[model samples]
Target chain A: MERIPILRMGDVLLVSIQVDMHDRLAQTLQEELAERVVKDRARGVLIDISVLEIVDSFIGRLLGRIASISRILDAETVIVGMQPAVSITLVELGISLDGVRTALNVERGMELLASSISLRTQE
Target chain B: MGLESNSKLVEVLGEKGRVSLNDWKEAQWAAIKIRREPITEEELYREASDFMSLFQQAVKEAFLSDIRDPVWLKMREMLSALSISRARRGFTPTEMATFVLSFKQPLFEALKQAHGTDSGALLSDVWMTTVLLDKLGLYCVEEYQKTREAIISRQQKDLLELSTPVVQLWPGVLTLPLIGTLDSERTQLVMERLLQKIVDTGSQIAIIDITGVPTVDTLVAQHLMKTIAAAHLMGAECFLSGISPQIAQTVVHLGVKFGDIVTKATLADAFGLALKRIGLVVIKKSGE
Candidate 1:
């Protein structure tokens, strides 16, 4: 069974989806992400998908679902590395990813996650 | 109208082509009834003369049935060039087609005078000429339409680029003043341009000015939100300016929520907000 590796750094879980994900892989990643959020007590989840040039509605929904699951588990999720074409495609598909936080790249994603998590802690 | 080996239409036209060409030129020059004449009479005469000579040479080398033969290449080139110019000069498709069809009259008269008193032979010859000339006329119209489409598409691209101008007001601040309808195509263009500019300049703030936009419906609002969302993903804050009182009422009545987006009534207000966000302030001098 192929599984997406979830790397933990301090209080954050970093997942970079570098492979072309199928339905099964996306499902597995969603389950693993939810479980890791609770087990590791992660404060934030940063997902880098800049290499993902194509984003269908299914993958778009999966991102939104993961954001929701993380929010429920008391962790903030920030999606990063979205290509310009992918952004246009997602918008065209009417997938707003309303609850999902997005950053330009991993570096900016880290900054967004750190700032957002700090804001949450203060609240 | 079977002619001897040497009496092919091509040879006949070649031998007496100058006479046929004069009649064709007169007929063509007189048929310029278009309100907006694209070419002068002299220019038209020159083109007509050139085409007749080319046609005579083409037919001399190949049968009329083989319209795509290499011999007719020059004729086709002339027609294509004429079609494009006519399209540019605002000539309608019918008028452009007429330019080619008018040649048929002189060719028929020349053929009749050459093959006098042979009714059966004249009918067949005229029929062949009709088919050939009709094909050429249709080709001219087709080329004219193609050229018009190309011109229209180029102008549309120019308009899109003109409407979306991304100006860097400050080091980390960019402004896009939109002055037209926000359709899906233009929205996509705006998003790509704004995102690329953000990456190029590393600008963290973008102000989209819509004061010039006539109206904002639900769909337009959605496009605006999508653009702002994409910019947000890029770690840049997007501010929308130029919300008039009527537009504000329309937005609220339409139940469109901007959700944490900073909206201002004018570009100046948005600029001020952008400046404040970037921690830049301009104070009045002691004695301005």
Candidate 2:
């Protein structure tokens, strides 16, 4: 699957997939998306996979792997607006996201990144 | 076969009227089969068909009556009540599978009379058989999980007859082969397990094999040491086996000595050492 459109508001990059994704593409996603997100050393990342109705084992595992790579590049990853079905399915499947952070929607994602960016500016 | 049993059947149906599939099967298989001689296929088919028509007529009359003089409006209420009954007795998959096994005349007779599992024959029956089967499957999975959890918990409990921990390479004696990372909780568990096994087994020796364990840091080594000590307290000797060259070097580098502990290079060697120590040194059979 192709990378979704990139939207930038100030230093924070809103990088969300327009299409629902599967598990097999996680590594390739990290390799490809990492380059775009890292360009000019962007401030923070906002991932919106909320439009996705279902999340199986493979997709859950991929999301975790993606979040870990995002951490290594010195950018905080905030997963925005996971559907209730996705949340329930993830729980039933016992998918663990120990290191990943989350938000309700893009607005909240922006709010979270704003704080992170301001904290960096203070330093 | 000679005399018609309708008069007797009418007499029974007059008092009770309705009979379940199980009761009907008992009446047929048990009451009739033993006393009378075995009948041919022609006799079986004739009797089966006779019962099917009789059953179908009775069901139609009852359903029509139920539809008219009924306070329970929805069919779902009746189905729900049946569901509750199925729950109380704990329905097995084999029983559920039997409900779908045949659509032949005798089975059709039993189903029509019973008003259960007949739903499978109709695409628009009172209740879909597939739905019932799905519910039964989920129940089976739940039952299996509960059984698995119960077995694990009972093993962990302090009961000699109940508990059975995995003891690798054994009939009477057992070897608890330790491998991988050991946290604080795992250390405690190892000690508890070794002590429990020693108390339960009444064996003279135990071998804590560490072959699959890649590296032994201080925490894991300490856990092993604790396990050995716990076993010793119960008057059983503990043998440490499968010390790799890399692990040996790490131990030397860490300056952690064995402190006069029983050590062996391989599992085979450990067995040999155990046998020799127990005075099985000389071969009584062909090979030494």
- Looking at candidate 2 chain B, the ten consecutive residues that score lowest on lDDT are B1-10
**Chain A TM-score values for every predicted structure, listed in order:** 0.95, 0.84
> What is the interface RMSD, in angstroms, for predicted model 1?
1.9
DockQ of 1: 0.38
The residue-by-residue lDDT of candidate 1 on B71-171, one tens digit each, is 67888899999999989998889888888888777777776776778767777777777778888898899899999999999999999989899999999
Error of 1 at B139 (Å): 2.5
Cα deviation at A50, candidate 1, in Å, is 3.5
The residue pairs in collision within model 2 are none
| Model 1 alpha-carbon drift over 4 Å, by segment | A1-42, A54-62, A92-94, A105-123, B1-20, B23-46, B58-74, B89-95, B111-128, B249-260
Docking model 1 quality class: acceptable
lDDT of 1 by residue, A3-111 (tens): 7799999889999998887888999999999999999999999998878877888998999999999999999999886776777777778887887887656887788
* Model-by-model DockQ, in order: 0.38, 0.01
lDDT of 2 by residue, B1-288 (tens): 111222222222333444343443444444334535344445434443444344344433342322223422233233333333433445443432232232232333433554444444332221322343344334434444454556677765544322224373543355867665556665566556665555455455678788867888876776676566445423356799998999888988888767647988888888777776545664678775
